[model samples]
Target: MRKIAFIAFGIALWIFLTPTLEIEVLLTALIASYVAARLVGNVKLRPMKILNFTVLLAYNFLVAVWQSLKIVLGLFDYESKYFEEPAGRDFLEKFEKIVLITLTPFTIVVDEKENVLIIHELKRRKGTE
Candidate 1:
C-alpha cells in the first residue's frame, strides 16, 4: 500500500515538474518511480500529505519569484531569524520541512540545530515595523 502511494506520488511529482505528456517521458517516470519506491525500504507514504506539500510548493515558488524580482528592484530587505520546526519527527519529514521553508525566496533555511531552523527572511523596506 505504501509502495503504491510512493509510486503515485512520484508520478505526480514527475508530471508536475515536467508538464509533459510524451509517452517516453511517462514511461521513464514510471520506471523511475518504481525504482525509487523500491529503494525507500519500509517507510510509510501519505498521499494526502504529499499532495498538500506539492500544492504549497507551487504556490511558494510563484510568490518567491515575485519576491525575488522585488528584491532585485531594491524594494525589500532581508534579516535572519530563528524558527521552530513546525512538523516532522523523523529525518525525511524534517528534510521536507526544510525544503518547503527554503523554497521561497522570501525565506531560507540558513541552518538547523536541535529541531530549530535558522531562517533568512525578506521584508518590504517601507512596511511598518
Candidate 2:
C-alpha cells in the first residue's frame, strides 16, 4: 500500500512538473515513478500531513524570499546558526529535512555534524545593533 501510494505520488509529481501530457510522457512518468518507488522502499503516505507540510514549505519559501530581499537591500543582517536534528529519524527523513532547509532562500543547511544541521540565516537588524 505504501509503495502504491509512493508510485502514485511520484507520477502526480512528475505530471505536475512536466509541461507536456503526451502518451510518451505518461508512460515515462509511470516507469520512473515505479522505479523511484521501488528504490525508496517503504514510506508511509499521510495525505493530510503531506498537505500540511507542503503548505508550510510554501509559506516558508515566500518568507525566506522576502527576508533575502530585505538582506540584499541592506535592511537585514545575516548570521549562521545551528539546528539540532530530531533523533531516531531515518536517512530519507533526514534527507527530506535537509532538502527543505536548503530550499529556502534565507536559510541553508550548510553542513551537518552528528545530529545537528549548520544553517545560515538572514535576520532583521535590531535598532540598537
> Could you say which candidate leads in TM-score?
1
Q: What is the C-alpha lDDT profile of model 1 across 36-129, one tens digit per residue? A: 8899869866668777888988988888889778768976565555556554688778878888889876777887777777777765445544
Each model's lDDT: 0.78, 0.72
Q: Model 1: which ten-residue window has the lowest total lDDT?
A: 78-87
The Cα RMSD in angstroms, rounded to one decimal, for candidate 2 relative to the true structure is 3.9
lDDT of 2 by residue, 25-103 (tens): 9999999999988887866677886666566666776777787687689775555555555522677567668767777
**Against the true structure, whose lDDT is highest?**
1
Question: Could you tell me every candidate's TM-score relative to the true structure?
Answer: 0.70, 0.64
